[model samples]
Target: MSRKYKFRSQDDLYFISTATINWIDVFTRSLYKDIVVESLRFCQREKDLDIYAWCLMTNHLHMIIGTRGRKMEHTLRDMKQFTAKRILEALAEHPEESRHDWMLWMMERAGRRMPGNDIYQFWQHDNHPIAVFTPTVLLQKLHYIHQNPVVAGFVERPEDWLYSSAKNYYSSDLPLLDVLLIE
Candidate 1:
């Protein structure tokens, strides 16, 4: 991991993107996306996470996040671990998941290639965190996060994406997770 991507300052906010292992398009399903949303909500409520903005895409997620009580990196690690576990469990138990076996096999193969993981690897290890040091940089990242779905052709507008905080920014609709709107 590069020093630039590591969370260095405890109090500074960061823009981060976390991707699925092998960019597997794991979040094409709503169940997996909901797992991520709920896990982020749990982190915000109990793990001292301050979510400024977020967007979930087909294979990755972007967020501008800060921390209050816990270390940002540690809280994020817990969130990823918990979300991965839950999503894997859901994949195993989902009766209608046509790609369940394939997804598990891919994750298991990824886990074997990685040294730290015991069985499966859902999320890639690197968060690719960029420090949001200035208002200009913050707004740039905020736009980047919201524009992801548009760039991906998932929606015509950023706020139309239900899994993102873009709607919260416009007060268009309530988002899946509460966000601390940037001013």
Candidate 2:
């Protein structure tokens, strides 16, 4: 892992990008997306996470976050672990899922490839955390995060994306996740 992506400062906000193992599009289902949302809510309430911005896509997520009581890395680790287990369970419960078998096999293969993984691996290992040191960089990352859904053709407007904080920035409509406004 490069030091550039490592958690080095507790006070600075970090822009983090984490993806599903193999970019398997696991978040295409509402059930799986809800699991990630609930885990993030738990982390925010219990893990001292201050989310400034966030976007949850079909296979990955991007966020700008600051931590108060716990290290940023530790909080993210717990979130990922919890969500992985929950999402795997969701996959099992939803046999109607068209991609169920293929998705499970892909995750299982990913787990076998990694010595540290148990029977499955849901998320890719690295968060690619980049410390946001300047207003210019922070703004840049925020724009990129919001623009993801639009660029991906999932939404016509950034604020129209329900899974992102773009609405918080661009509209009066409340976003699915509460976020601290950047100033």
Candidate 3:
């Protein structure tokens, strides 16, 4: 845990990115991606998480988030832990997951290299959090988050990415997860 990326202020919004261990394309499957979406929804509904924007890519996720009641760090920790466990379980139980064995091996190998992991590590330790202190920076991060899928050639337009808040921003359809619209 690097102090540099630690959430220091509870009220301030932060842009954070959490990657899969070894950058494995774990989220290429809809089951894994649904796990993340449901986890975020859970955090928002039960854990006082305030999500302004989010994007889920094949291997990583980015979000602009803050906290209202609980500490942001704690909420984030719970989200990551819960999601990791659920996603790993889903992978194990998924009958059609062709890369299940290879994915588990990679995660297990990465987990063994870490100190606290008991079996496997799903998400990388560092979130690479950047405090969104200014409106300019917030917009920049929002643009970056929405454009990730486009840059990766997953979509021709940012709003075409169903896993992001860009749809909520650009159209009337609700986002995959609830989002706090930024003004």
Candidate 4:
């Protein structure tokens, strides 16, 4: 809503955080998380997105991202839209989801209260995109992103988190997402 959060320049990389409506823990399951992973992969290949660093938490995703082709806002918008629909379907069909009805109900309610989605709103509208201007800010955001799971007590080490790019940074044999290293 303010000039500070707006994407002013296409050439500048931004540190972004997109969270779920009502802070729902939709990504507690790997199935839903994979949808985001695949979407990021698609964006990297098809949309010319440059993902420098990223981390996926239970409810929010943080990334230091730039793009060579598409507008940063558009790339994020498309990614969120596709992931929302696909993850909702996965929630509907997931046999082991204990909170299936509740999660969908919350998102639907949020949608009604929010501006965009007609029925259900998965990601909260504001991306909180902060332009990454300096090497210091980039490193700070990068550390914050990778250490999210560790700070949240989800894992003992940043690389222990299966869904984060820390694995890729830490020489993990198989990371879920491939990131362009800034270091």
Per-residue C-alpha lDDT of model 2 across residues 1-183, encoded as one tens digit per residue = 366569888989999999999998988878888889899999999999988899999999999999987999999999999999999988899888999999999999999999878999999989999999887798899989999999999999999988888878887554422334533
- lDDT (tens digit, per residue) of candidate 4 on 2-117: 54578888899999999999999989888889999999999999998988888999999999899997998999999999999999888878856899889888998888887655
Whole-model lDDT, model 3: 0.87
For each candidate, what TM-score against the reference? 0.91, 0.93, 0.91, 0.90
List the candidate 4 regions with Cα displacement exceeding 4 Å.
1-4, 172-183
What lDDT score goes with residue 79 in model 2?
96
Residues 1-183, candidate 3: write the lDDT tens digits. 347677878878999999999899988878889999999999999999988999999999999998887987788789899999999889878857999899999999989998978999988888877999987798889889999999999999999988998887766555433244533
lDDT of candidate 1 over 1-183, digit per residue (tens): 456579889789999999999999899888889999999999999999998899999999999999887998898889899999999889878957988889899999999998867899999988988999887898789889999999989899898999998887866454333334433
The candidate, 1 or 4, that scores higher on lDDT is: 1
Q: Identify the superior model by lDDT, candidate 2 or candidate 3.
A: 2
TM-score result, candidate 3:
0.91
TM-score of model 1 (CA atoms): 0.91
Pairs in steric clash, model 3: none
Q: What is the C-alpha RMSD of each candidate to the true structure, in Å?
A: 3.5, 3.2, 3.4, 3.7
lDDT of 2 at 101: 97
Q: Which scores greater on TM-score, model 3 or model 4?
A: 3
Per-residue lDDT, model 4, residue 44, is: 95
- Which regions of candidate 3 are displaced past 4 Å? 172-183
CA error at residue 167 for candidate 3, angstroms: 0.4
Q: Global lDDT for candidate 1?
A: 0.88
Residue pairs with clashing backbones, model 2: none
Worst 10 residues of 1 by lDDT: 174-183
